[model samples]
Target chain A: MEASGEVRRFAHQQWPYEPNYKRVNGWQMHYVDEGVGNPVVLLHGNPAWGFLYRKFVKPLSAAGRRVIVPDMVGFGLSEKPVREQAHTLDGHIANLTGLLRQLDLRNATMVCHDWGGPTGLGFALSNSDRVRALVIMSTWAWPLPPAEFHKRIFPWRMMHAPLVGPYLLGHHNALAGRGMYLSVVDRKKFRAEAQSVYEGILPDPGSRLLTWTWPRWIPLDESARGLARFEWLERELRKSKFPTLLVWGREDEVFDHATFATRFKELLPHAEGPELVTGRHFLQEDSGEEIAGKINRFLDRIDGKQS
Target chain B: MTEIHVIENYTPEGKRRAFVLAEDRVGHYPEFREFFVRQFSLGANRLERPGYVRASSGMIYALVFIGRSGEPFPDGIEIYALPDALEPLNDSDVDADLWALLRWMIAGVGGEWRVEQLDATGRLYQLSVAANA
Candidate 1:
């Protein structure tokens, strides 16, 4: 499925916000192709698109890294196809698969967050050869923790909930407010300017649902498909043994730091580094410059291996 | 009618109190009694010091802190929205949205407000809300 009218408007107006890139599949796929070297694929999560990596684009590129940030369908400058199926994890993986095949991205250093965790993991799982290293932040790839409401109302149940879910997500849940951005941030980093930029991208109600619907669609508990997908990726990570770096926000309000560590450690224990960052869920937004610096150093360590 | 119910008192330092508050029958932030006492001059006494922080009162109420980094600012306290005490604010019409729920969860509980499966894998969500500024 393609992006909906709401996300379409978002793609048209909100995008090209930075520089480089153009329309693909009637959706605005923003990308920065500069410097030139192997490639680095950065996938963002819900309530965000390719724009999330606006800062990393230039630096990584200047350092001779072909950084590719695609606003996955239903987010940022990418097309927001509202159909629940359109935004599923597997579907996204497929979309990314096609994009990678088309772009011929290889030896990539993936920087993933929130929903991007699974999406990026999915890519690595399938295209194991393409990945050189990974940087995961404030996100999870584990199956849903055992919780009832978390079981029922995850990204799936809540998205398709009777009257209540849609209303809460599509309208009442103003994407511009704290519901979308504030929730992920640590209290110490909350600021008006950052909030303004977030609110600025999403001016109308339609464009906002793209933010609200993301969490609702995650099949947290009984999502066999998502679980299977995640499991398959985990198996690959274990089998492939690709280097991975995890940076978690200790004070995160969404996914707890300890919980994130316990799960990721079990999955990628062999990976070089995984630390609980004293940041928030929106690590890129809250600590963008810091995160970029970390990524720069992390990738250099791996890229330097060949040199 | 304004309602104030004690939800917890188990700290060992100053008094630690949690209250279930109602505004026009609507549930808002769950405030700590001691902070209210200090900030509003309520003069409420703690059962003892560190009464609420160190001990578990065996109840589920939202925890609140006034300042960032879990600092308990005067009048900034915890409000325990007892399970039974949680009543639908609206019967005929509802203004509650995801945003409202997010705000209430943040203000009411210092952590995320997640409704998990009543009986399942224990899946949970850390209901993220706005800062208390």
Candidate 2:
């Protein structure tokens, strides 16, 4: 699905970055490349594009690292594939891999959040030599026992219902509509313009095929398809020695720091602190500056070690 | 006398706040609400948000509401204006088409109903409704 003229104009005005695209994995993947040094690849999660890290690009790039933020296929300014079957965990991993290879990004620092953790880390684990450091936040790479949050499935369960899922997510845009609002700790920080862009990008049901399929992609049980892939990622993450930072949204209602973050630390025991920041699901909107500062400091420490 | 109360309602596909026009009669609101709901082809196509319903004469109407927020709002019909509902041909004609539609709705729910605009403070005023309208 091509972005509407109105949505394109609004995104350009708010982000003000040169829109770059590369045809990777049979789709036009959009990205923002800034600075000229060791590459720092930022990957955004479901229902959002590269715009989620708008605040991080300038600051991180200015600190002397090339910042590469991709919208991923089926999101942001990227061409959205209408088929539900086109969106899958492996498909997304391959999508990211294709983009990285096209850009030939190596020894790159990976910053991932939400669905990004799996997509970005999935790539990092496969090509360990290409990934220098890792910053993981508010996402899971492995399946977990159902928590209290997953049990309360009033609207969430309804969203995945056979007929209802398409109507709510694909049509009503339930996730894109109120998901961000409900996820954010500070409503004021979730600007109206940003909200408009998120909601506006996929205006129709066909455009929202990816958004609708994502929630169902959550591997809940034994029959889940991504179970083996996630298990592989978890095993690889535990053994990997790349300097890793676990930055978590302390107040996140979805992926609570207490549950997911703790699990992440246990896996990557050698990884740096699970530095709890004040924010929610989409923490970048709430604490982008704070997170960026922590990341810059982490990078500085790594650079100092290399020097 | 038919008095219309405006309330703010939530919609994902449409605008955040809709111009909810409710009638004064208690028992008569369901009928009033149903009359307008029949106009738009909503549901599955749009959860709670109503899109423009084209008329036999090729005229388009944005009477897009049928749900309630549990708020103590006297229910009627919701008419979305500007940006989404009716794309006004020009800036100067923004209110013209809307007022004309409101007149049509008022005429449908017939009576010597005097229209008054409800403000944010719950204070009412004769802001848009003309004495002749």
Off by over 4 Å in 2: A1-11, A145-147, B1-133
Evaluate every candidate with DockQ and list the scores.
0.03, 0.02
lDDT of 1 by residue, A137-237 (tens): 76777565412334433343433232223344444334434444545555434443355556555554455555545554454545344677666666766
Residues forming the 10-long window of minimal summed lDDT in candidate 1 chain B: B21-30
Model number with the top lDDT: 2
CA deviation > 4 Å runs, candidate 1: A1-28, A146-161, A173-176, A184-190, A223-225, B1-133
Predicted complex 2: DockQ: 0.02
How far does residue A67 in candidate 2 sit from its true spot (Å)?
A: 0.6
Candidate 1 global TM-score = 0.61
Give one digit per residue, the lDDT tens place, for model 2 in A116-189. 88899999999887889999988888875324564333445334433334444554565775677677877765
Cα-based lDDT for every prediction: 0.53, 0.67
Summarize candidate 1's per-residue lDDT along B28-128 as a digit string, tens digits: 12232332344333344322222121112223334343332332333233333332333432311222222233333223333322333211111122222
